[model samples]
Target: MTIEARFRIDRGSFTLDVSLSIPARGVTSLLGPSGCGKTTLLRAIAGLERCHDGLLKVGGVIWQDGRRFLAPHQRPLGYVFQEVSLFDHLTVVRNLEYGIKRVPKSEHRVSLNRAIELLGIGHLLERAPGTLSGGERQRVAIARAVAVSPRLLLMDEPLAALDPSRKQEILPYIRSLHQELEIPVIFVSHAPDEVARLANHLVLLEAGRVVATGDIQTMLTRLDMPLAHDSDAAAIIEAVVTGHDENYHLTHLDFSGGRMTVTGNAMRTGDRVRLQIAARDVSLTLERQSDTSILNIFPATVDAIIDEGSAQVTVRLLAGDVPLLSRITKKSAAELGLEPGKPVYAQAKSVALLT
Candidate 1:
C-alpha cells in the first residue's frame, strides 16, 4: 500500500506548499518545529482541514481531490490528539463502545476487548477518564480510537500533554501497537527523541516546506539535514538474534559482517530487530585488535569521508552490506591516514535498541 498527498493551502498569512508520498504500512512521522504546519498537514490528510487545492489518497482510495473532499464522518480515520479527548462522563469501556457503536456490525474488525488488551487498559475499563492518570487516559483514548478499526490511525503528539515520566510510561504501549497493528499510522510530533523512537519513515518540515523525507536511517545520518547536527546523531541497523551467553548474561545480535553483544530485550532466536548506534559513542581503530574490551568488531570499509570544517569529519562506512556512520575529529582522520575504502573497526560502549 502507498499514500500520495499534496497540498497547496493559502491562508492570508501562512501558505503551505508541499507534495510528498508516504509509505502505507509503517509509522510515518510528520516532524517539524512548532507552527511549521505539521498539524495542518495532518488535519488536511484526515479531511479535517479544508483547502483550495488539496489531494490525498490512502491505500488506493481517494480521500480528497481538487473538487471533492470526503467528509470526516465518512472517512475511515481514527484520530488521537495531544489532549486525551475522551468522554469524561463515560467509563473507559463506554468510551470505547462509543466508537464501536458508530460503525456498522460488519465494519467492526477490532473488538472492544482486543483494543483494551492491545493497549493494556483492561483494568481501567471501569474507571472514568477523570479518575485515570495522564498515561492511563491517553491509553484509553488510543484504545477508543482502535476500537473503531479504522483504515488509518492519525496521532498528533498523543503523549505531548503528559509529563516526562508519564510520557515514558505510555511509550511501550505505543511501540507495541506499532509492532502488532496492521493499520497504517501517521504520527505528528516536534520531539526528536520521540520521532527517533517511533518513526519508521520521517518527513522533516521547516517554514511550511518539506526539506527531507525518507527512511529513518537515511534521514538521521544525512549531514546535510538538520538531524545530523543534533547532539544525539546516530545510525540504525536491523540485526538477527543469533545467540545468548548465559554466563555473562549478554544477548548476541548478528549484523552484516560482525556480531554485537547488546544488553538487549526479550527476543526469540532468529528474530530480527532494529538497533540505534550513536555516532558519538563509536571510536575507530585501524587494525583489528584482540586485547580490547569492546566486543563488536566489524571490518568496515570507508565509503565517504566528509569534512565538516573545523575539527569534525563524518566517516561513512560499509560493514559488509550494512552501512554505518562514525563521527571523528578532522585531526584524527589526518593522523590515522583515513580515506575511502580504508578498513577500520568501530568500538562502542553501548547501542540503543528500538524493536
Candidate 2:
C-alpha cells in the first residue's frame, strides 16, 4: 500500500507544486524549514486546504480527485498538532473516549485498551490534563489519536511545544508507535534530531518545493542535500546488538558493514539499535592503524568527493554495503590523493545510540 499525492496550490506569490508516492507503513517525515509548505501540504492532504487540481489516494481509498473530495471529518485520519489541545475539564480516559466515539464500533481497528497500553498511558487515565506534565499530556493525545484507529496519523511537530527534557521523554513512545503499529505516519518537523530518531522515510521540502525524498539513512548522508551542509551532519546506521561486555560496560552492535562497540548502551543481546556517526567523527587514513583510541575502524572505498567550501570536502565511502561519510579538509584530500574507488580506512571517533 502507498500514499499517492499530486498537489498544487497557489496563493499570492507562494505556490506548492509537488507529487509524492510514499509507502503506507512506517514513519515518513515531512522535513523542512518554516513556510516551506510542509504544513500546507499536510493540511491539503487532510482536506483542510483544497488544491486547485490534485489526486490523493491513501492505500486503496481515494480521498481526493479532480472534483471529488472528502472533508477532513470524513477522512480516516488522526491529526496531532503542536499543542496538546487536551480538554482541561476532562480526564485522560474522557479525552480518549472522545476519539473512539467518532468512529463506528464496527470500524475500530485499535481498541481503547490497546491504545492505552501502547502509549503507556494507562496510569494517567484518571488524571486531569491540568495536572499532567507536558510529556504526559502529549502521550495521552497520541493515545487518543490511536484510539480512533486511524489508517494515517499526521503529526505537525507534536514535540515542538515541549522542552528538551520533555522531548526526550516522549521520543521513546513515538518510536514505539512506529515499531508496534501498522499505521503510516506523516510527521512534520524542522529538527534534525527528531527526524533522525523517528523517521524511516524522509521527504525534504524547501521553499514549497520537494528537494529530496528517500530512505532516511540514505538521505541524511547525501552530500548534495542541505542536511550534509550542517556541521552536525551524520550518517544513520541500523545494527543489531550481538552481545555485551558487562565488565567494560560496552555493547556490541553489528551492521552490514562491520561491528561497532559503544559504551553505556543499556541494550540486551539481540536487540536492534540505530547508530548516528557524525561525519566529523569519522577520520580517513591511507593505512589501517592498530594503535588508536578509535575502536570502530573498517576498510572503505571512496565513492565520491564533493567540495563543501574552500577549506573542506565531504567524501562519500562504501564500507562493504554500508554507506559512511567523512568530512575532511581540502588540504587532507590533496595530500592523501583521495579519489573514487580508492581503498582507505575509516575511523569513527564517536557514535550516538538511537532506536
Candidate 3:
C-alpha cells in the first residue's frame, strides 16, 4: 500500500509543487532544510492545508480529489506538533482521554492501555500537564495521539522544542512506535541524525519540490546526493545481533557486508538493530591490517569517488552488497591508487547503534 500525494500551493514568492508516492509503512520522513515546505507537505497530507489542485490517497482510499475533499476533522489522522499543546487544566490521562473521545469507540484500534504502555507513560497518567517535564509532556502527547488509533500519525518536528537531553529521553519511545504499532508515520525534520535514526523511507525535498525518494539506506549513501557530501554523512546498515561475548561485553551484529562487534551486550541475540557508520570514521587500506585497534574491517570494492574541497575526497564502496563510505585525503587516494572496482579494506573507528 502507498500514500499518493500531489499538491501545488502558491503564496506570494514561494510555491510548493510536488507529486510523490510514499510507502504506507514504517516512518517516512520528509527531510530538507527549513522553509523547504516539509511541514506544508505534511499539512496537506493531513487535509489541514487545502489545495485546489491537490490529490491525496492513503492505502488506496481517496481522501481528496477534484470534487471530493475531506476536511481536517474528517481525516483519520493524529497530528503532534512541536509544542506539547496539552491543556494546562487537564491531567496526562485526561489529555489522552480527550483524544480518545474524538474517535468512535468502534474505530479504536489502539487501546488506551496499549498507548500508555507503548510510550512508557503509565506513571505520569495522573500528573497535570504543567507538573510534567518537557519530555514527559511530549510522551503524553504522543500517547494521546496513539490512543486515537488513527490510521496515520503525523509529527512536525515533535522534538524541536525540547533541549538536547530531553530530545534524547523521548527518541527511544518514538522508535518503539515504529516497532510496536502498525500505523504509518509521517515525520518532518531537518535534522539528519533524527532522520537517520527514525526514518525507514526518505523523501528529500528541495525548495518545495521532491529531489529524491527511496529507502533510507540507499538515499543516505548515494554519492550523487548532497547527503554524501555533508560533514556528518553516514551509512545506515541493518544488522541482526548474532551473539554476545559475556566476558568481553561486546555484541556481534551481522549484516550483508559482514559481522560488526560493538562495545555493549545490552541487545539480545537475534534482535535486529540499525548501525550508523559515519564517513569520517572510516579509513581505507590496501590490505587487511590485524594490528589496529579498530575491530570493524570489511573488504570492499570502490564504487565511486568525489572530491570534497581540494584536499580530500569521498569514496563510495560496496562491501558485499552493502554500501559504505569513506572520507580520505587526496594524497591518500593517490598513494593507494584507488579507483572504481579496486579492492580495499574499510576500517571503521566507531559505529553508533541507532536502534
lDDT winner? 3
Residue pairs of candidate 3 with colliding backbone atoms:
none
The C-alpha TM-scores of every prediction are 0.95, 0.96, 0.97
Question: How many Å off is the CA of 135 in candidate 1?
Answer: 0.4
- Write out the backbone clash pairs for model 2: none
**Lowest lDDT 10-residue stretch of candidate 1:** 346-355
**TM-score winner between candidates 1 and 3:** 3
Give the C-alpha lDDT of model 3.
0.92
What ranges in model 3 sit over 4 Å off? none
Candidate 2 runs further than 4 Å off? none
Colliding residue pairs in candidate 1: none
Clashes of 2: 0
Quick one: how many clashes does candidate 3 have?
0
User: Please, what are the lDDT tens digits per residue for candidate 1 over residues 1-355?
Assistant: 8899999887778878889999998899999999898998888888888875788989899888878788888889899988879998898888999988999999888888888998888888888789888888999999888889889999999989999988888877777776777878899999978887888899998878899899887887776887776667778887899998877777899987588888744777898777888777777988877898887777888878777658898877777777677888999989888988888887766788763
Residue-level lDDT for 76 in candidate 2: 94
Model 1 quality (TM-score): 0.95
Off by over 4 Å in 1: 264-266
Instruction: Give lDDT tens digits, candidate 3, residues 102-214.
Output: 88989988999999998889999889899888888888999988889888999999999999888888888888886888889999999999999999999999999999999
Tens digits of per-residue lDDT for model 2 on 25-98?
A: 99999999999999999999988998757899999799999888998999999988789789888898999999
